[model samples]
Target chain A: MTQSDLTILSNREIATSVYEMKLGGNTISIARPGQFIDLKLDGFFLRRPFSVCDLENDVLTIIYKVVGRGTEHMSSLTAGSVLDALIGLGNGYETSTSGASPLLIGGGAGVPPLFMLAKALVSQGKSVTAVLGFNTAEDVFYKGEFEGICSRVIITTADGSCGIRGLVTDALTEAGDYSYVYTCGPEQMLKAVWSKINTSGQFSFEERMGCGFGACMGCSCETLCGAKRICSDGPVLYKEEIKWPTPA
Target chain B: MADTRVTLCGITLDNPVIPASGTFGYGYEFAKLYDINCLGTFSFKGTTVLPRFGNPTPRIAETPSGMLNAVGLQNPGVDAVISYELPRLKEVFFKPVIANISGFSIDEYVQIAAVLDKEVQVGWIELNVSCPNVHGGGAAFGTTPDSAARVTGAVRRVTKKPLIVKLSPNVADIAGIAKSCECAGADAISLINTLLGMRIDIKKRSPLLANKTGGLSGRAIFPVALRMVYQVYEAVRIPIIGMGGVAGTEDVLEMMLAGATAVGIGSANLVDPFICRDIINSLPAEMDKYGISRLSDIIGGAH
Candidate 1:
């Protein structure tokens, strides 16, 4: 991992409380698509961890939602503001395992990392389809961005204010013959996807972290192999080894 | 350049900066970021007789200039630590490490401490007497002088290496506890383990940490730590490893003046991985600024 000061190229509201920030810095250490970045914000003791949405040249794209005071401060940052960030954190998605046809699923803030995953698979000559879910149309984001790269894009909202009119699972039945599933989102949504999906897939999980490295074991999650730290071992895990059985 | 070296329990350290246990991992985590040999030494993760998966999720909560952790001492058990972790640590760190062990019984403490004493890399044994002694009605051993001295004497019999009784600040009488441990043959003392604390999520209408409570550490506890170190310095003759919210070099000097032979950086290491290394690097300049030629000369200077 590399610690570098990233200058904000742009930080703007994309949808409702959601924001897309472009940071300029050395992106060579970003090993894979699903890996994340931990940002050290001013006035905060713990550094904030966010998923990497896109990376091109020296510019790093991250999408975040204003969940608390930390994000609230990030939203007000102007151009030329620099952030100290621990870049290329956690194990990202392993795209080589994605078959010829892969379906990407995301819910709310979870949509950001899949956008990068979709781009990675598309570039690998794989046919990519994305299922983007939100609470409502106002919370929806990156629908068009996914549409630009994926062969097809499906949007779902819980309130029926958007495309599929249900949770992400509602649209999965007709999402075509996708060979694999790669998803990121809230735990409740991930549980739904874990049960609904039939194919072998990968799921990216989030946890409140300390250190955002291997030291603290603060972000550890139960797995078939053992208790693995989400920050370093993964924000991404294969569907089989994930020990969190579907909800009762 | 200022002299940063200090002698602790007959062993000389490069500086009085040892990364506290749990925050530094096995030391290799920071070794990948920078050379860890720059540290005086570090206390490895808290080990137990059995592997503890630790507390449930949301184990971390951010407070003002500090954080809370109820990680339940999630370690791979003592046997695994001896075989797996120590081997991994050997490749990255060159200095002898402080083996921090916790227990629910005196026998348990003796079992682990005796085992660690045989390991060539263990220079000191830090007995974390904060854990509830299951046999003692679940009250932490460090909370009372009797239990604290009991555990210290039990482990002291097995380990010939320097024994540092790490005290919990949750007690009503910390200085009394320190004096008891010293009487029981503790070679040194480390004070101010995280103060017991918790936070609530108003939206969820429940606790923020899954365990409901956690130990508070970081910049928020510096003053309290220094005070305890100062008090313990007055109560005992053993060396003091004072830590709690120590974020910079000035704080290190202050801790030494408060009678700490060493200062440990806990949660601050989580904020910036290179904090201990950076502190060690800047210590000389900070010492020069303070007009102190020797850090050893400052131990309990305030007293």
Candidate 2:
């Protein structure tokens, strides 16, 4: 990973408590769609990890929710504010492994990484289907953005305020069959998608991380192939190897 | 023109800047970023007899100028480390690497030590007596002088390699514990491990980390680590590898003067992946500013 002072080009709230931030920096290291960037916020001891939502030459975009003190601090910053960030962290999704038809599913904050993944899959000439999930209509974002790139877009809300009523899994019956599935969201949502999906796919898992890189084993998870670090071996894991934790 | 080499437990390191365990993985990971051979040597991840999955999610909590982690010594079992991790490490890192071993029981510690002692690349075995995340073993042996010495003595018997007992800072008398390990035949000592600390999420009215508490390390703990290293230096004659929030060249110099024969860079690695390399690269110029010619000459100079 490379550390650089990235200038914030824009910081604006797109949805309820959700924000879209654009940063200007050397975007050379951000080589993959599912890769993330870790920001060194002032006064905080650890750097905060955010997935790359979109990347253009010298520009990076990320979406974050105001969940904690760090993101809250991030929302307070304006354009031209500089952030010390470690770019191109974690193993991103392997697009080369995608089949002829691929499905992308995202839930809440997890939708950011899928945006980039959808773009990459579409650019490869593969038929891509995007499924976006949120709790309510006000919480939904990037619907128009996904419509521009993906072949089909399915939006799901639990409150029935928008699109289909119920969770992402509730809308999957109408999403048609796919050769591969890629998804990221909360554990419950991921488990539901993993159980309902028909084909082998890649699932990106999130854990509270220390160093967004492999150095810290703080985000380690147990899998069929021994213990793997979520930051390195994944944020993305294939369907075959994932072993879900027994519910408490 | 300055000599950066400092010998730890009879093994001479190219420099005194060794990346601390848990922060540097098995060396191969960082070796991909920069030439890790520039480092004195790095202590690999804390190893145990049985493979560990570590603590639950939200294992990390941020503090001012520091972070607390309850990673609870997550490592593939010693067998996998020796068979898989070390072989890959050997290809990238040519120098003798320090092996950091942690266990839940005395026998487990001895068993792990005995296995690693036979590895040719392991220059020193850093016996972690103060891992705060685990339940029964780790810090329990470190908080008291008696148990610290007992674990030290048991492991010291099976390993012919230099045995360095890592001390925890979350103790009543850190120096006493250091002296106890020294008296129990520890070849050297390394301190201070992360301090026990916690943080609360006010809105949720719950602990930030699922583990509830973790060991604090980074720039915030440097002064506390320096004081403990100084106190331990006065109490024992064995060589000391000082670490606890050591980030830059200045911190490295200060740690050596406070009685560190060598230094370990911990939390700083999380902040910057290339920090150890940066510190090593900047040491000579910084050393020149302080009018020091030989890096080893400053060890315990403050005393």
Which candidate's lDDT is highest? 2
Residue B206's lDDT in candidate 1: 100
The sequence of per-residue lDDT tens digits that candidate 2 reaches over residues B24-58 is 99988888899999999999999999888898878
Whole-model lDDT per candidate: 0.91, 0.92
Q: How accurate is candidate 2 locally (lDDT)?
A: 0.92
How many Å off is the CA of A229 in candidate 1?
0.3
Best by DockQ: 1
Question: Candidates' DockQ values?
Answer: 0.88, 0.76
Clashing pairs in 1: A35-A92, B218-B245
Local lDDT at B159 for model 1: 86
* Candidate 2 interface RMSD to the true structure: 1.2
- Write model 1 residue lDDT over A172-245, tens digit each, in one string: 98698889999999998998899989899999999999988888988998899899999999989999999884
Ten contiguous residues with the weakest lDDT in model 2 chain A: A40-49
Error in Å for residue B36 of model 2: 0.8
